[model samples]
Target: MPIIQFQLIPHTTQDGLPYQHLRFQITTEDGLMEPQDLKGLKLPENVQWSQGIVIEGKGPIWLYGYLVHECHPSSWVGCYDPRLGIVVVSSHTHAVKVGNVLPIQLPA
Candidate 1:
């Protein structure tokens, strides 16, 4: 259960339209990145279901989104944006801050 932490970077969709749904580009300190295709991505249960409104378009969709983002056994993950509620782990191509606080999962 090696947990690896990363940051979530928000971006506009390809169409340049900003729709709902937590979107991000995952990245790591060692330069490891991956696409969090929820369809096949084996992320934590907390990261999966907490995407949008439980009823989906029912009560009130989340303004930003989940925070924990997404993850896989690869040790990649994201967290609730302390700034924005936007969830969805990202893998962007930016130099991970020199000392960004991140979570570290234990080895299984």
Candidate 2:
């Protein structure tokens, strides 16, 4: 599995809804891969998403979601699977930051 570092940059939609731009990078034997960005992800509100959080990856498709911090116990949990091209979020409450990892999984 590859470990990726992610940073969430804040943005607002034309309709005035808050969203984030997910910027991340992965390192491989070939060296550090190019940084990629996923725009307009409407994540949970009120949680302070951190920058440079490291996470593990399964393959070319990465999962972006929230986690529970001792200080931040969230009632809501959500995930954004780029492979599925959809955002799945359940009931809302307190929350913490977001992180993910991305690796190009070559076929066996």
Candidate 3:
């Protein structure tokens, strides 16, 4: 299962809003219960919850995690330039999987 979390960004808009991020993490966490067992999981109690973006959609998040473990670098994400590799990493946190195809952008 992915470790869900958020990052804080300062807003420069008129009202200075708080930008909250949702991370359906594909972390280096050693072992997790099967995706089926995450249990329609509502996020935990007393943890920081985002009021910024509402996540909506139906799809396999954890299953995508499984597929990343099997795909190649350029197959999933279109861009895989070696020269841009370092630049790409600086842009986002790399997906921690058993393979090279980084899943930086998650399923919507």
Candidate 4:
């Protein structure tokens, strides 16, 4: 199996609010995955469930809500920010950088 990487996209929603959503891309896989492929998606054994995909700096970005969208295989997964009313697709992920070291965690 290949390692699946996910990123967060920051954009405004229809109402023009700040928000971000998750977008997944396979690192070593040949093609995109279907919605069904995410049914039982789980992190690797070395990863911790408490770890979340960092969007900003060292802190974790919390999702206001989660939604399932009808999208192509290349970009899948959607989330909504009620506070800012923003929505994002095919977003990017941020890694915590400190001096010469960097740490990153993925959403479980």
Computed on alpha carbons, the lDDT of every model, listed in order, comes to 0.28, 0.33, 0.29, 0.33
Which candidate comes out best when scored by TM-score? Answer: 2
Per-residue CA lDDT of candidate 2, range 1-108, in tens? 444454454543233333343444454665343324223323334444432122223324433332322112333323334463213243243332233222222111
Which has the higher TM-score value, candidate number 1 or candidate number 2?
A: 2
lDDT of 4 by residue, 38-101 (tens): 5555432332222222122111122112123222122222333334322233322232122212
Model 2 is weakest, by summed lDDT over 10 consecutive residues, at 99-108
TM-score of 3: 0.25
Number of residue pairs clashing in candidate 3, backbone atoms closer than 3 angstroms, sequence gap of 3 or more or interchain: 0
On residues 37-61, what C-alpha lDDT tens digit does candidate 3 reach at each position?
4445443233223222212122355
Indicate which candidate wins on lDDT.
2
Ranking of all predicted structures according to lDDT, beginning with the best and ending with the worst: 2, 4, 3, 1
lDDT of 4 at 80: 33
Residue 71 CA displacement from its true place in model 2, Å:
14
- Alpha-carbon TM-score of each model against the true structure: 0.18, 0.33, 0.25, 0.28
Better of 2 and 4 by lDDT: 2
Model 3 error, position 93 (Å): 30
Tally clashes: model 4.
Answer: 3
Model 4 TM-score relative to the real fold: 0.28
